[model samples]
Target: MSQNAVVDGAANAVDTQKGDYPDFMLKEIHEQPRVLRETFAGRFDAESGRLKLDELPLSTDEIKAIERIYIIACGTSYHAGIVGKDMIEKSARIPVEVQIASEFSYRSPVFPPNTVAIAISQSGETGDTMDAIAIAKKAGTPVITITNVAGSSMTKESIATLQVLADQEVSIAATKSYTGQLAHLAMLSLYLGQERGMLSADEVADAMAELEQIPAQVESILSETSIASIEAAAAGCYKAHDVIFIGRGVGTATCLEAALKLKETSYVHGEGYAANEFRHGPIAMIDAEAATPVVAIAMESETRERMLTIMGEVKAYGANLVALATEGDARAAELADHVIYLPQIREMYLPFTAIVALQVFSRQIALLLGRDIDHPRGLVKAVVD
Candidate 1:
């Protein structure tokens, strides 16, 4: 579809509500906490310790029978899958693989019988993703889709669908839908874990409680203080030629998405690398005089020490260092030139808080650079064939 066609379709969907928002992107970004809430509403029962994800095509028996899982997506959806791969493998004890949709559609990958293929797409019309889903369906593999649009091609073609309904998500760059997709994946992971006997019902109930608190924690990140700090970080990025983000564990997915947000909106040459991966050889490229911005995800986790260690390495290079630290992480504060403090949460949900900080920082960077925050130059909302 053409850009104007997509915009017109989105505009027509919410034309009556357009006046309610300042900028489409900002409105969508701020709506994420609510989107997370709505995405999981009534889908989890803490008291019953049951996940009401019957909407998924597979039953408990089929879920447990599955030998492996493949998640196919593109762009931000692919990042969500990186996080989802961890969620499923840890909770469900399933060997999961995430593939870029365009590549998967062309690669002729093999899967075992009962392998489940999940396609994650916000628009549901991502051409490459849809093509991959078609291939899975043709092979008689059960196909499930998580999509924002109820009537999209992806939803209709799937055996079952997890409808995120993340509002219209009209902005060229995604915001609310990304978080919404994460919420759906979390619920799916918990559900599969309980059904597959990897997690006790009681344990899943406890985790569900934590999932419920994510939105409030995210709301806390949207405070005046948080926005002010992000603006400060953005100031340093105004003339930056390169911005590098690094993290570990699930935080690696956080780093990738965060840097992508900066590049997507600000057109800064941003890249995200695993902290250890950067140490291997990429570290030598860092130079103190470049004033290069190197943002580190030093949030509390098992990998906290390693992330801090990598941050210190970057610090030695005399690059402009910024850390996204947890509320009481004094070590992270001491390690970097600037710190964006997030509320203390478990490592699994750190991406939720960390990604919001990245989005705010990227938005401020675009605004400061006088670039189009919503419809950035030379970018389209979706790469539909």
Candidate 2:
């Protein structure tokens, strides 16, 4: 047997070796709230009006001088970039572009002067992401890396690096690392916004304080009643032939990551789309027989009403709508065929909670379908290419 199999067998034999945890997925899932809390601790200083990112390689002036931002990442990190793009653009008033590492490296895109490339990866050793960073460096763009692993390739290659502090993640499907990435990126956006004079001291301080509480709130959500509701939804999805995930704004990235989890583990046909984009062409694919299983992210934002309207359309078309919304969102609850109540987090942080629900949903679906949650077919923990 392989070394990994030997370790798995040994872990199964000793209850103590597992440390009272069932699996890596469960342990990692439970760690999200705590990881999020630790990420914000000591990082934000209200009095100085500066977000003190310990061990970051870039100076305030360098960050402020950045004229363009390019985020390159793979898998879940890429999803985080999608949310980060929105955060940076809105908060810092900077134009940002996010690209998958594999595509970005090979596509030979033009990089302008004064462009700051942010490379994100959990392992930091993803060959494709590292290659993309190398390409950016060769093209004379400064590189900043956000990574979980401290001494990995991406961290070493970039001019500046911010660690995600998620520690070790054993599950092939990422959980805590995804949230950790969000926390770090959110803080980065806040810092950059302040430096660029796009955000006021009051705004940055308020956001920082609210973010510091996210880990506790996320922990409560996992331990609260929502876990069971998410599991049941996952069980229903296991038998479905296809699943559709929908959201607007930042939630769109959450939808993409959710679909990715389902597709990666359950070997099901899953697609994630912006709720507005659904009307453009995807709606024609929906019907009663083999009806698509829809997971909707209905957060309290400017897009909330529009998201609910899209959910109504999904339900009207006979699609099974499983809506995740904050507590007391009566309209979302009314339209949803199934409802999972999540805690109210910052709009930028909503993706972190929504992703937890997706992780639970995907894992349960994999279990009900008898697929290996840690080792899905035709996939490795790291996509090197």
Candidate 3:
């Protein structure tokens, strides 16, 4: 077989492989920490506390002139862009809009001059995403892409590209690439934030320090005994008709990603809402025995109290709540039906830790339902069309 044929065959074989793990979903889910570590390897310069984006083709002035950013992606990558939008806007003080590539291409949104268009995809072959890039390029917007495959269409076509180094993501449901994309975006946001004077030297250093510890923290989560609790919760909740995921700030990104995972893998009806937004309307859906399991990502930020208030309402409605809070967050733990204690990382960096829990939760639920965890129905490793 030729190289392309070999890759295609390996992707197909993912569905057929069976072992003590039972499914590709479980194996892919468990591979997260290792993949995260590998993604960050040699990408950070600890001595200068700078993210080395030497491969990216933008000068400091070019980066600094970026007044607007539009991120185009699909599915899981789109969810990661939602997180990236929040991070880049808050940290870099640059206005950003995230759009699904399919919708963006069809609608043809207005792109201002000096607008930076970022295309995010693991496969680099997503048709809609590539089409969106073509549209953006035609409109004279500078295009940059973050993708796994080096020579793929998106990489080859964009003005600049950052390779995610996620190496052959065979599983239909993305695990490591999602985290890898988030990590890369986080570092990029930090660099831009520092350049714009939005982040102080100390703040940049602190974030860099936290980023360095993520791989180790992820490794610990993968090896820890606490994963059993996640598995048990998944077994009990997978059959529910509807599930709700809620969080604030970066946690909202986690909530969105979790909903996507459950919906994609278990074929469960899932919705992710900002915790604050639930009060406006979504709360009506919450009821006793409703199985509206709320996953709250509570960090030690100003939004913590707001998230706690939202959880309070869910509790009053007698809705099942699953809280992912920091180690010392006693208030969130008390309100939740089940609380998963996470390491106390910085507010901005907490998403990295919370996502791992959701990955494991989705895998266990797929296993409980006796579904093929890796190759969920109606999905493919790459959307080549």
Candidate 4:
């Protein structure tokens, strides 16, 4: 379908209500804490410190028999799969391949015995994902789906379904749904890990304890003080025609989603690159004259110092530098032209809090540019085809 057709169809098809909030996107962004809570509820056993995904039909033996996993989705869901890939591999000791559903449908991929396919979609009706699920089923793989809507097409096709419980996301650019997917992915990874004997009860408990705090941390990010800082950061870059987002490790997936949000809402050219990959060629685009903004995810991690070095290079090139740093990082504050401080959490979990800032930043920039933040032009809530 053409972009113009998509825009026209979205106008008539989706709900554009803002209610008490100024825009649907912002409303969805603020609803993330509740979304996270709902997604995690009844999915964990506090007494045993293990995940209880009774909804998942795969037994312990079935999970243990899994040799490989395929995560198929597109756009934001694909980025969520990237985060899931790392977490599942570390926790479940299983290899995972994250694929774009549209591409995967065309490729003659091999599905080894005992393999499973996880299909992620905010709307269970996404056409490419549904097609990919059909392929997986044909290959005799059990399909598990993570989605917002219960009993949707994807759910009907899958052996088991994990509902993200995000409710109705009215905005074309998804906010809470993406977070909901992450929350479910986190739980599913832990569930698989414990069932497969890769993670102990104590380890699961420690992770769950940290995960439980994410809702509160995200709520803090939506606070007035945090919103003001994010607005100020957005103000610094809203005029740019192009923006660059860079991160390492799981932060890289966060960068990809953040960049997509910016582009989708504001009609700006936003690109995400791995921090080290920036120097390969993208760094040359950073010019003093253009003042291209480089948003760096410089949170506390093993690669933080390297991130700092890259920030120094960006500054040397005279590009505006925006950093998402851990709370109370003096070095990051000094190095950045604008800083959105994220709550102190382990690097793996930082995506929950850090992406909130970028979501607000993208919305603020859209508002500043007088763009429709809720239903962005040429975009739909779901791309069925």
Candidate 3 residues 1-385, lDDT tens each?
0111101111112234445666666666666676666656676676776666665566677778888999999988998899899889989999999999989967859988789888999988999999898899889887778887767888767776666756667678888788878987987898788777788777877777788788887766676566876776676677778888888888887888898888888888788888888778998887686666666777677689888888898888878888887767889878987777777788877888888888888777777787777778988788867
The residue ranges of model 3 lying beyond 4 angstroms of the native Cα positions read 1-20, 46-49
TM-score of each: 0.94, 0.92, 0.91, 0.95
Compose the digit string of candidate 2's lDDT tens values, residues 1-385.
0101100001112122336766677778887876787778887775686777545545567667788999999888999999999999989988999999889956777887678898899888999898888889889887787877766767667766677767777778888889888887899889888877889888998899888878777776787487888887776667888889989989999999999988887888888999999889998777678667899999788889888888998899988889999988999888977888888877877887888888888888888888877777887777666
Better of 1 and 2 by lDDT: 1
Identify the candidate with maximal TM-score: 4
lDDT, candidates in the order shown: 0.83, 0.81, 0.78, 0.87
Q: Pick the candidate with the highest lDDT.
A: 4
lDDT of 4: 0.87
In terms of TM-score, how similar is model 2 to the real structure?
0.92
What TM-score does model 4 achieve against the real structure? Answer: 0.95
* Candidate 4 residue runs with Cα over 4 Å from true position: 1-17
lDDT of 1 by residue, 182-262 (tens): 887888888899899899887787787888899888888898888898889889867888899999988889888988898
Model 1: per-residue Cα lDDT at residue 252:
88
Query: Which of 1 and 3 is ahead in lDDT?
Result: 1
